[model samples]
Target chain A: MRNSIDTGAVICSVFAAVALFGAGSLLALMGYLVLKGLWPPMRALAALIFAHSGDSLLSIWIRSLFLLLAATLLALPLAIGTGIYLSEYTRQNRARELILSNIAGLGEMPPVVYGLVGWGALAPYFGEDRQTLVIVLTASVWLLPQLIVAAYWALQEIPVSFRRDSLALGATRWQTIRWTLMPYSGRLLAAKTLEGMARVGGEAAPVIMVAAAWPDSSKQPLHILPYYLYRSLIEAVDPATTRHFGAALLLVLTSVCFQWAALRLRRTGVVAGDTLPGLRKR
Target chain B: MRDSKLVVRNLSVYYGDFQALRSINLSIPLGAATAVIGSSGAGKSSLLRALCRMNELWDNVRTEGQVLLDGQEIYGPDVDVTEVRRRVSLIARHPYPFPKSIFDNVAYGPRLHGIKDKRKLDEIVKRSLKQAGLWNEVKDRLQESALNLSPGEKARLCIARSIAVEPEVLLIDDPTYHLDPVSAAKVEDVILELKQKYTLVFATNSMQQAGRVSDYVAFLSEGALVEFGPTSEVFARPKDRRTEDYITGRFS
Candidate 1:
């Protein structure tokens, strides 16, 4: 009773089911972590992320937060600018294709590759331990491709006619971009920036390889949440060991909070899949 | 109106390896509404863009011609495309208001030209909106987002936005094509009103609209100027067969 058309439909349905199951499995994993995470004591969690005295969790959390902020400030403008140039200025061609392909390749490259690159690049000028500002900068560079892709897509979603319309109305090309494209794409760019924050915020491998342990005593950087989690789990005594789980909970919560902020932004019509009051009617 | 004369001599346009418009000669008088009517691919839009130097925006589009606005060459080396466009604004086939409040959309062009006085800007916004016939509907809600307007209102808003800058000429490319008959009629009325202050050059497929609003008619075919005269004379007795064919609906 399987007609030729029905066979294709059956195959497509099986593929769709597989895709859904894969998505559901990831969702379930995050859901489980969040469910278990809320049960921990907030005091312990705070101590884990904030306390700095002698292997205290707070110091480690602060280190990670510092690194994340440093990376964000350094990386966002370059990444967003690259995305804009590629999406707006460059005509479609081989060079554009090659750049996009490289961005995709860089996005998937292992965190350890960036760690190694950071180590080599920073060792001579900064030092060997990848744990300071250098490592954070490196990790952000690693995360740059993702931010650019997101920003590019957001910019692309704005119709070309919008730019042309403004220019036709006697606005300079830059003026048109500033007044029209930038304001419209503002939410999307912010969302993309938040995504970059989350990516750097959650990562552990690059942070571990590049970040230095506490008390170089002169210049200490790159001791972030993930690195803190690793350091506490491996180096701390049993009494202090509870901090690792707490740090894990903190990192997860930070990422979740970042995502929640992005979602809230989207809901408030600051990001993609939302429309601003300026563009909804016609 | 002293800058009334626009002279085009030996204008030719090419798209990559293909020629789109042959040697073309045309003149437009200031303060008169000229209607360019032709079939698709007749290079009507190309000619309009050429006048504004917007054709230069396309990499593959090459023009070898002289377009002079008030005896000064528009395509000359020293001419600023931005300055030319500031004097001669264009309305696209589709209407797109800037992504801003109705008041801000009207305020954009003036702001760009460094008109920082908010009160003067407000007056310009209101007056422009009034001239475009959108003031009565949107006056109270000027600060509200422009995206909330109906399609006709949005198109009028675009016109109002252009008028805010007080351009010398307004080049409208088929503003009513996508509109329903009623909205199209309303827009046409706005155009008729607008022709008093600005030199209006409008492209359209509708012969009826051309007859109604145009002071002069220039019929084009295959990228060549076929016939042109006062609107009343051309429509009543079109000299060219192509113009006759187009007017009678025998062919595009």
Candidate 2:
């Protein structure tokens, strides 16, 4: 009160400022999206979202989930392993520096670029217009660098003392990483996998390039959400398309679900120097 | 010629061409507590590290000389540095506990040397922790993470870890620098008691610690071993003027 007016007033003002800032940005974007996009399509929502189109929405949701899950399985382990190898096994040298810089550069490459590369290289080798497997392959390569970078950063954030301590205890290099490094980095690795999932899920360009898009129920090679959305937008007659909005909502919900799981795992993962049960002295 | 358990002869260490330690020679008796007393940059820690072969872990760090354990050249061409380190373990100045449970920290050394029997591991862990004077404080929390220990407890845990493998020689580099006087005194007491089982060589900046724990004392200055004798003789009646100046705190 003596220094900066009343404490209560200051607290109230700070809360007011924070609330305004928090709600202002979201309100602005949601207001714009509703006014410009969702509202413009509102009259057709019931027919577009809820109407059962035989196997249309179901097929798209299944394909998208399948591709996302498959790619995650294929890429996640390799990416995490490479990340650990680089961060722990490979000390800083000219070659290690070169490899790390290459990873960063690969991560920055656009999705479209990856699409073209996959089309030119992988698609030809595996044959084009393939099923969900090719889509998985493309997604694996596209998300690998990002996952590796995230994991590498997570491992690097681990204090060097942790490793030194492990070694000092006569733990072998691999043992130290397994017993100490991996557990400590579990949260960040899980979070990175979630980020990679989102990247893989939303990828539209690569699937389109390698897996040809057909709107017909049986012919769409992988019929992932993005590919289906693009097909309904560009090829299918706009007003007559049956399941686009529902598919969109499903994709959004799936992303949200995966993100929630990631957050939960992050909360429970081993923290830096986390104490064991029944050990907290005070 | 003295019968010594550990012999360091003409040992020189360089970190990327900057000499960290010059030609140094000292002999440490078996099952005795020897302290290296010096100021910072006095090569006390380097000498201790060379004894355990831990200095080879660094890159662009070169050493010339012989560190002998029981009269066998430890750093010789055919010697396994890993095996040497396992036989002669070191505890650093600052306590760095692994990101693991306290039990795992103490069990690590035995596990490395292929001791997988859980019951044996348990006994070693308990014995080492007890010897480090940390058993009472952490017995109930053996499964707790080592990093969660207090600074003093962490230091003690490190000592326990080093001793778990039943190493023939224990090297402690500035073992109490990060500790308070009380905790430092406690660790010093542990070190004194530990010498009965293993040859103990420690580096300490505190002359009082050297006098208190060391059966033999070696005075090091500017990367050289200036004087070496029994602790009482070195402290009570100095042979070299520099040793007297250093011991009396007239100069470091």
**Which candidate leads in DockQ?**
1
Off by over 4 Å in 1: A1-54, A128-131, A211-220, A234-240, A266-282, B1-4
Cα misplacement distance, residue A70 of candidate 2 (Å): 1.9
lDDT of each: 0.78, 0.78
lDDT tens digits, residues A1-282, model 1? 669989999999999999999968757765665454434565655554466564555666566677778777777788778877887778766888898988978877877887776666754466554446577677778878877887777677676667777777777777876777777777767776786788777887775655532334334354567876676667767753355566676687678788878777756552333233343311
lDDT of 1 at B211: 94
Question: Which docking category, incorrect, acceptable, medium or high, applies to candidate 1?
Answer: medium
The TM-score obtained by chain A of candidate 1 when compared with the true chain A: 0.75
lDDT of 1 by residue, B1-252 (tens): 224457888899998887777888988878889999999889888888887877766657789989888889988888888888878898877767765799999998899899999899989998999999999998899999887788899899999998888898898989796798899999999999988988899999888999999998889888888887889999999998888989989982
State, as a TM-score between 0 and 1, how close model 2 is to the true structure.
Answer: 0.85
Query: Which portions of model 2 miss their true places by more than 4 Å?
Result: A1-59, A211-218, A240-243, A257-282
